[model samples]
Target chain A: MRSVLPVLTIVAFILGFWTLAVVPMNIHLAADQAARGDMVVEPDDARARQEVGAFALALGNPAVIPMTYTLDRPRLPGPQQVVVELWNTVFAVAPTSNRSLIYHGWVTLSATLLGFGMGTALGIALAVGIVFSRTMDLSVMPWAIASQTIPILALAPMIIVVMGALGIQGLLPKAIISAYLSFFPVVVGMVKGLRSPDAMQLDLLRTYSAGPAQGFWKLRLPASVPYLFASLKIGISASLVGAIVGELPTGARAGFGARMLVGDQYGQPLVTWAALFAAAITAAALVGLFAALERVTLKRMGMAA
Target chain B: MVSVDGNPQGLEHSAKTARSAVISASSVDLTFQTNDGPVHALKDVSLDIEKGDFVSFIGPSGCGKTTFLRCIAGLETPTGGALSVNGMTPDEARRARAYGYVFQAAGLYPWRTIGGNVKLPLEIMGYSKAEQEARVRRVLELVDLAGFARKYPWQLSGGMQQRASIARALAFDADILLMDEPFGALDEIVRDHLNEQLLQLWARTEKTIGFVTHSIPEAVYLSTKIVVMSPRPGRIADVIESTLPRERPLDIRDSPEFIAIAHRVRDGLRAGHADD
Candidate 1:
């Protein structure tokens, strides 16, 4: 109850503001339609009336003001309209059907999972390389950091075009872009974790006559668990964003990003807002799952997560 | 006062009277080349440690005692001179698992439980599971932590944690035990109790032990031989042989013989400072 109260209050506040915003955003069209209807003194000249602005006209007419919530094509959909659209798209169609939000969600989810796996592997490998070799530490670490500085927006289209040129149409190109965005965090995190063992601990390993492989397995790798899971959380969210971004530029016919693009092009704000909320919720669920895993792993390792 | 080269002869002659020498160092020196300049950590240090001897290196801070111990464990290499463990190079002896080392801090892996920490060296050396379990049990009992095997290192008191570290070193059953200020962090009462326990453990196992400490009473109470060292280019200031008997209780610290040996150690430390 303590945590939920603040969330509820914030949601109610946003909904109230959104309901008020709908009036102003759709007021012009509502007024124009009302002016051309039976209430108008003239048919063609009603919208061109001299005295009042559209907002003022809508405010004065009760019927016109109410039309803002009931518009078929609104600039910004009301909260109730978005909720209804979400309910219909998620439940009304078969899960495998193209029209269902579940089908689109699975498409995005597949790419995100695949990208996250590849990114995690690449990041850990690079981190190991950076930790053990001074050459890689001096050379590759700077490049890894520099790679993230390039805007993903600018990079995503280029990756899509390059993969399209190579005749790879779906999934792989998006996963590659996702891998590119996610690997940096894991690299930085694992480097710190691998080096977490202090001088005395290293000396202990030496006294045991343990080799580098033994040192890593017994000390560095186990030491890096908390860090690895922390990085994975950040990487997974970035992977989801990369998948959505990949869908935007490639003119995708399916997925959450495609649904948003289609709704935007057709001026159906309800579809777009519903898909946006679904993407957010999916990202939250992914982060939550990893958090659960981190708690278990760290606790088992005798580390307080 | 004996010169550095003159003292090793007397210690060797004494060591020859009872048991064979296990560790012999002659003019061993280590100078760390940091970015600022070369700083000498150990200089012209010579010593002979016999088998079954409880040898303690007592010194002020920056004394080469810890450095010399690390060199024995093959964690650091000396820049000059000869040091040997069990008739081989320090590195060779390390590879052969001839000694077990306890650091100044507990240094237990937090991810591992007390039993797991004790089993670590045995695991690395490829001991069978049953053997590893038996050894861990025996050492835990040796440290009086037999019931706390499943507890994490952080859950234990600092004194218990250090004992757990000692248990870890004892797990492998090596002939020599190298401990660097294992109880230096504990309270005085705890330190005294651990000292008594350590002496008992040493008596039972008869392991050749090399210990480092800053406390003169600790050195006098626990050692068959004491090597007093000084800082700023660390070197041995004095070597004192204890005439006290093997069996020592907590009250033995107040004996005149103990005080006489401690005073000699203090004079050696003063002499090292006078040279500086």
Candidate 2:
């Protein structure tokens, strides 16, 4: 309860700030809406309203301040607007409906999970190779580091186009981009983990005349678990971002990215804000799941204090 | 034991002793080439460790005691001269799994229980499931850690963790044991208790043991043969065969013979530093 209070306070603070900011951001639109009604509005012409600053318009027509929060197609949706949209899109409709955020969420989540799995596996394999072989350590590590520097946004469209040409349409292209983004952290982290054993530890194994495979399975692999989990948390979030970005540029007509694009094109700010918040919530949940798994696994392994 | 004096006669004498020795090192030198220049870690270091001998290599840091121990365990290679373990080259003997080595630190894998850590070498050696269990049980009992097998290393104290490490080393039933300052990190009270337990373990096992340490009383109390070493082109300063009986108690360290041996080790260490 003590821990939860701080989080609640911060969340409340953000909501309060958002509620205050909505008045100025949506005031111009509210003024026009109010002017159409029997309510009073200063500089009632729509073009004059556009020319005037939002804060100035709100000051000119104080009666329009209350209507700002209720405006349709608000420039900056209020927190309550986003919350209602989220409730309607996520819970009010069937999951299979195009209007439901759950349907879109599942689309993005499937690609994220698939890509994360592929990326983690490839990263671990590469880390093992780099650790055991001098050639791979020298050759592959530089390339892996270099791969992350290329903007995923720039590369995602190219991957979609290339894969689309090969008749690979829906999830695989997005998953591949997710895999590409997610693998670097795992590679770097797992490499550090695999090499964490000190000189004495390695010497003890050498004294036993333990082979490389035995050394890896017995010592290196166990030592790397904490490191691997740390990377995995970072990797999963990166994978989610990759899945969303992969939806962008390709005009992939589903997932959080598509919802965001649709909301943006149709001028439904509440829809875009709701999708954005849902994506944030999903990323937090994914990371939280890994953190819980890490706690349990490390505790079972006696690594956690 | 034959003393190495850098003479033809001394060389011949060591050659004769090497025949019956379990570990034989003749003029073994190791020069580590750093950016500064060649730093001689060992120089003409000769020693003959017979079967069932509890030998301790005592000296200051950088005196090549641990290096020499590592050479015997095949964890290090001498730049010059021949060293053999069990009638085979050190590397070949290592492959044959001739020795069990205990390092300075406990170095238990935090992810493994005490039993799992002890079972590591046995698993690597491909001992059968039944034999592995039996050996782990036996060795844990030998180290007085029988009941604590399920406990993790972090759950144990430093002394207990080190004891578990010893149990791990002993699980494979090797005929030779190499230790590098195995109790260096412990408190004196715990160190003394472990030293007593180690002597008992050594007596029961009767394995040819090579231990490295800088502590005067520890070297005197634990070793049947103490090789006092000197630094700066590390070489043997003295090799004192203990006159104390095999059945030693903790109080035996206070005896005249034990003090005499410790005095000799102290003197040898001082003499090594005289030239510095």
**What digit string (tens of lDDT, one per residue) describes model 1 on residues A1-305?**
48799999998998999998888788777666666566642223643544556566555665667878877788877788888888898998899888789999999989999998999999999999999999999999989999999999899999999989999978998888889989988999999999999998998998999999999999999999889999999999999999999999878999998998998988888888889988998999999999999988887888974
A-chain TM-score of every model? 0.90, 0.97
Residues forming the 10-long window of minimal summed lDDT in candidate 1 chain A: A41-50
Q: Estimate each model's TM-score.
A: 0.91, 0.96
Report, for every candidate in turn, its global Cα lDDT versus the true structure: 0.88, 0.90
Q: Score the docking of each candidate (DockQ).
A: 0.72, 0.78
Query: Model 2, which residues run further than 4 Å from truth?
Result: A1-3, B1-19
**Worst ten-residue run, lDDT, model 2 chain A?**
A40-49
Q: How many backbone clashes does candidate 2 have?
A: 0
Model 2 lDDT tens row, A26-116: 8987888888889867896888779998788888888889888887799988788888999999999999999999999999999999999
Which model scores highest in DockQ? Answer: 2
How far off is residue A263 in model 2, in Å? 0.5
